[model samples]
Target: MEFTEPKAYTRSLIPFLDRSHSVAKPGFSRWLVPPAALCVHLCIGQAYAFSVFNLPMTRLIGVSQSAPGDWKLTELGWIFSIAMLFLGVSAAIFGRWVEEGGPRKAMFTAGILWAGGFMVSAIGIHLHQLWIIYFGYGVLGGCALGIGYISPVSTLMKWFPDRPGMATGMAIMGFGGGALIASPLSVWLMGKFASSTDVGVFNTFIVLGCAYFVFMMVGSMIVRVPAPGWKPEGYVPPATATKLITKNDVYVYDAIKTPQFWLIWTVLFLNTTAGIGVLGQASAMSQEMFPGHITPVAAAGLVGLMSLFNMGGRFSWASLSDFIGRKNTYFVYMCLGFALYITVPYAGGSGNVVLFVFCFLIIVSMYGGGFSTVPAYLKDMFGTRYVGAIHGILLTAWSAAGVAGPVLVNYIREYNVTHGVPKAQAYNTTMYIMAGLLVIGFIANFCVKAVDKRFHMKTDEDKDLGAARAPAGAAQAVPGRA
Candidate 1:
């Protein structure tokens, strides 16, 4: 409302603006940002590949005892969960910094802290200190998650204002695929460095920690946002595009006050919870349920396979959202996701591996799609002004889902284990619960109206002019990867 074309020149929240107030353009290339930023994403995606290291970390501590009774599964788990707690909380807390510091600064910070976390964990293993590993990995991993999650979406949207979903998807898809790379890497590193005699968990931890730290830093140098004032060549948002949220272009602060923010938050929370619940304990769940046939390692391989599904989903589903619109895509994911969850537990005595894999992969893609889609939705609803901040805030839902997902899967598995029911049957009960959450999400997605009419910023002149001056960065925003 304060923006005045005729009377005054003011700071604009548009992606690339300079001190002189001339519009900025993509400094280098928009499409280049995704591949460069994906380095950080792949590291954060290690969250999916967590189970690969859990066994080694646990054996270094809990399972090292001569007897089964000596170890506690609960203690070993605290490290990973503690890290995630920070991942969610830090994103919102540091989101402003992420925006101000520029993507390069943020990315470098993530690379150092995350890689250092591994080194710290390695030391903890060598010195036989469990708490140290918790502190080192927890805080550092949290930082990585915060930055990696935001970088590509923020940069991509700036470059590809018109197709925000596809741009974000291309970058985030790498994040989803991270576990695919990590699972194999973790396996190889563990095998190579593992002390043959004493369960050399310490040595393996050190080697891997160092390796990841070095690998992540390479990408940090390349990550950057576009120059100010860049828009795609020749294209402009129609008066139609401006009419939707133009007058209502609220600041991130103002957006939080609106109902739309909360509604979308709820949608993201449930979507993430449904996917993560299955993902966290997948291998263990698979082995426990199909103990006669599937080994934990094979089940873990299946989980890695799910990572491929997760990765592909981010790219394909989100790219599709650019065409179909985010709200509609979410409708499909949630409504279908609810049904998928319902089918999962009942996979039953049929011994159908194919059916199980198909169902799980669909769910994983939905989860990935939800993430890849939301930033564009944020751009649509909140305007680009505070979108990065708003999107960062929304990720708090992911943090919440992180806790909820594992708890739901593990608690049910534990309860069933205690009751002497097979873990597989117990998993069925959890799936039913997941179905209910997805139903709730589907309902929430239905509730998001176009940004309230009052918030629209399209003026008579803006309508007449109609994005004739869309910044130079627009061209960088290539279409969905066909």
Candidate 2:
């Protein structure tokens, strides 16, 4: 479908929604874009906190309620799984479309789909239909998550070419902290809306959907694309010739053809796989490791604390990447992450709670850092022209890791338990496996090299053709010669 002017009534409004037409005034600070990006991210980042609804959802048709049977945990797990699976699929499929559509249109569409998913879920809950809930939250909402997640990344990198890491980091960090804000807020809202006749989850969904719609619209309205060739005042592109940074553009279709893309994909897949493995079992791991010492409440608190590290790492490590370069940054993540995973068994065996928690904290922060830095890394390798689409395709690694990590860890633990390993020791095998994954990621990162000139969009005509095919906001003229 042509992104320029869709025939559908809803999509017809896209041109009006295009913020790129609004020229930035003189001295316009690029700083404003991060907050706008954050508005959308902070709202949609609530996906991380979806677990807060798991218990309430399972009981939706339970003994306490009027219905006959309760939803099983396994059934509810599919809800989240479906959402994540679609998040990757939609992101990979719609990435180029979003690039063609521009941030305003992309974010606006995401808001509608995400918010609408919740409202649909409310209907599903009211009707007590699992499939309806799946369609509503899993399919529609998951698409929203994918679109929203990548929406700000490319824009931020373009606006802050001088410091892409810091810019993207600021926005992506909201994704990590989103649970911090949403989890408690969901609990509070559910309680506030609850009454004798209702558990209040349905009402909470309605309220959250409406509230997110408004919040996301604020981002869509406020976000503006930088004019063609615009740059920050006094900013200068680095002069050093290195394999890590580039000035050439690669089309999205061409990006996937390169070995660099797959290498980075593997790097991301391994890092996320290892990190998420630990994250999925954080509370359980904590309690099991220190059977008598760590209470369930304390373990829960540790989970929350890990979130802080995850959020903080997004900003800190990404910013650090600006100085060290993207490849070096991943080297740190993989090498240190491997060491950290290896130490978890020791920490847990020795009953050193502080050391165990600290090790995981650093690991998760690096995990988040990996996410925030990858867009800039893509820009460094492929140029900003198709960064959005490239990043979108790359997120399939995340989708794969989402499933791979938990399943790998769980399977290992189960195997160990079956062999008479203690619950605390069960995680040891999993930790070693995670460390091995990181070793592979380290090798992938080490092997990364510049994309060959054959893949580069080499001519002015080629650049123009690329731009003309995309929406006005989606395409920008290459930065003018300094």
Best by lDDT: 2
- Measured on C-alpha atoms, candidate 1 has an lDDT of 0.71
lDDT of each: 0.71, 0.86
Q: After superposition, how far is residue 33 of candidate 2 from its true place, in Å?
A: 0.4
lDDT of 1 by residue, 326-412 (tens): 888999998889888777766655777667778888999899899989888888787764577678888999888887888888887
Span of 10 residues, lowest total lDDT, candidate 1 = 473-482
Task: Please give the RMSD to the true structure for each candidate, in Å.
Answer: 7.4, 3.6
* Cα lDDT tens digits for candidate 2, 215-316: 999988888777766788898876764777888888888889999999999999999999899888999989998999899999989988889999999999
Candidate 2 residue 119 Cα shift, in angstroms, is 0.7
Backbone clash tally for model 1?
A: 24
User: What shift in Å separates residue 325 of candidate 1 from its native position after superposition?
Assistant: 0.4
Could you tell me the lDDT of residue 224 within candidate 1?
54
Compared with the true structure, model 2 gives a TM-score of 0.93
Candidate 1's C-alpha runs over 4 A off are 1-27, 58-73, 196-210, 242-249, 284-298, 349-352, 410-425, 453-482
